[model samples]
Target: MQKTGLLFGSFNPIHIGHLALANYVLEYAPFDEVWFVVSPQNPLKNSEDLAPAQHRLAMTNLAINAEPRFKSSDIEFSMPVPSYTLNTLQRLNELHPTHDFSLIIGSDNLINIDRWHNFRTLLQEHSLLVYPRPEYPIEKAVIALPKSVNVLNAPMLDISSTLIRKGLKEKKNLRFLLPAGVYDYILQHRLYQQKKE
Candidate 1:
């Protein structure tokens, strides 16, 4: 079975941090491919400042265009708002029965995994590839993590889409923070620009 890592995110603009982490996971982990699962909306997060799903999906597609092992997924676009990971996993299994899917998430999310919808069953049925976040310490949560979850020593990228959007709104040049073509796409679409009052 081919192991696929599902990195779920809003991917408002899909930056270098996302690509770098995915690449690092592929190199150091056992995953055959990493899929960028672009979310339409996160139940746990506010939708304010979120780019349109089409734009987010397009940006994600642009960022991973050159990488064969990387894929962009819009599985949540047509699903109900506030999409749940469990549902997405079930859908993927039905669509691609041969591929083995695992959740790729930051340690911060792992610590709060219980808050997710049907989390216990999600953890029991699928594996997780957790990477470190600067603020979240996995050691404290080790006792709570399931046996199927594995932590990777991949580089901790502190970059975030929130800061990227802020920088763009502030007229800061953040091209280096994003993957090739993504910055251009954001610019061309005038995304994340401050709306004049």
Candidate 2:
């Protein structure tokens, strides 16, 4: 049976950090493929700063073009906005019965997992691979997570999409922060650039 891992997030512009996490998970864990499930809108975030779903998806594709193990998905775009994790997992399970699915999340997200829609049910169904973020504590998160959670001390970079956007707005080069193709795409589209006062 094929084992697939789901790395769900609002990949505003898929950065090098995101790719690093995915690659690390694949290397450390037992998964055939890692899918980048791009969320349309995160209920907990402000949508104003988010780029259009299509644009984000296009950028994600460009970012992952060099990695055969990384696949970009727009499943949430087809579903309702502010898509819930439970629903997405259920749909994926049904559509690909032959593949065993696991959820890959950051330690920070695990701290707020209780707030997600039907989070308890989500935990029961899917195995989880939790990675550590810059400041988040793994031990503290491990105490709160269910038994299905697997904590990974994989290599991490202190880069974020928010930081990348800020760099773009300031007209700064995002040299190693994002994939070369993705950086070029952002410049070509003038994304994240501040409007003239």
Query: What is the C-alpha lDDT profile of model 1 across 116-172, one tens digit per residue?
Result: 999989989999989999989997563477789998999998999999999999999
Pick out the ten consecutive residues of candidate 1 with the lowest summed lDDT.
139-148
Candidate 2: which stretches are off by over 4 Å?
Answer: none
- The superposed Cα distance between candidate 2 and the true structure at residue 61, in angstroms, equals 0.7
What's the lDDT of the predicted structure labeled candidate 2?
Answer: 0.86
lDDT of 2 by residue, 82-124 (tens): 8998899988988889989899998888877877898888888
What lDDT does model 1 reach? Answer: 0.91
**Decoy 2 TM-score against native:** 0.95
- What TM-score fits each model? 0.96, 0.95
